[model samples]
Target: MKNSNIKNIIFDLGDVILNIDVPVASLSFAKLSGREQAEILTLFKENDLFRQFETGLLDEASFRNLIRKLVDSPDWTDEMIDTAWNSLLLDMPVERVELLKTLRSKYRLFLLSNTSSIHITQVNKILEAATGIKNLDELFDKVYLSYEMGIMKPDPEIYLQVLKEQNIKAEETLFLDDNSDNIKSAAKLGIDTILVQKPVTILEYLKDYAV
Candidate 1:
């Protein structure tokens, strides 16, 4: 049964609200690094630099430098690195933002994104061009970025911190994410969760809840 006491909503950005193409990033990196897409995938998936970058252990410059080293190209420009890294991000749907606006009247809204700095700049630019909004804070009550918080999802600490800081009851909050592990982690902490599968949208899922 859906929780009637859900007074706050915590949303995951990638794939849940934002349109992301993970394979696009692999293709971009393949072209930039002169390596096969499969190799690029394995390198990044197994590399700690990507996780470190997401959790703020690695700054933007250091992250780019690591990418440059991986590509074995001493002269890779920052733009090239950013393009490859941000290739996964597509566009934010207007409907999702509109849904957020409507839900804000009844529920406190928050954004918890496991994302990097360069991706955020691109996201803002795209969102503003489409919706005329400056950034996500205009839609959400608060935005918790993994890079800024030095914590990422599935750790349980980040979710706990958000609940404590926002003074929200775990049982009264609904968390939505595209990752199963993330959904499980939140559920374990007493927060209701939806594992948002692809082709299933936040707007569709929240219809009855928001109403």
Candidate 2:
């Protein structure tokens, strides 16, 4: 399908623009929790705490308390917990930001990320430290965070809400995400989508569209 009608672009944060290392997080959490890395990974997949934290259902203090309980260690400091939790956020590629800068002139750009407070904080810090940009605000017209919106990707409501708030039509909007489920959900809503895959960055995938 031709996406020449797509004028607004919605970009996913993790794995699309920023690199994520889930195994690194598991290893880091394992160090603090005294559990095996495999066990920690399993817990991360099976536990509702992670999803709750992402959707803002659990406050930072409560999330930390839950983590403490899960690890069976109440004495761990907030910093330590944050360190382990943030291990998954690796880095944001400068090339991706440069591409966004180029595309901003051609498309109405927005950021739609499913992330929590801790992860967002770390992402901002990494961006500022590496590129001298405090956050993605300058790169995007609007930023919609799942934690702040109390919604996440793969949910039809979030896409509909973005379209309504941005005053854009679904057929005119393009959504790029690394996850297939997210792409499928957006596609179901009639939004053009590109499933960002490994070995091919967003720039590589949308090279023709941006021009």
Model 1 residue 163 distance off true place after TM-score fit, in angstroms: 0.5
In candidate 1, what are the lDDT values of residues 1-211, reduced to their tens digit? 4578999999999998889987898799898777899988787777886689999999999998887777688798999889887888898899888899999999999999999999899999889987999898898999999999999999999999999999999999999999999999999999999999978899888998767
TM-score of each: 0.96, 0.95
lDDT of 2 by residue, 38-154 (tens): 887777667787789999999899988988877788999999999998999988889888899899999999999999999988999998877889987878999999989998888
How displaced is residue 56 in candidate 1, in Å? 0.3
Give the per-residue Cα lDDT of candidate 2 at 167. Answer: 95
- Scanning candidate 1 in windows of ten residues, the lowest lDDT window is 41-50
lDDT on C-alpha atoms for all candidate structures: 0.90, 0.89
Candidate 2 local accuracy as lDDT? 0.89
Rate residue 79 of model 1 by lDDT. Answer: 91
Residue 83 Cα positional deviation in candidate 2, in Å, after optimal superposition: 0.6
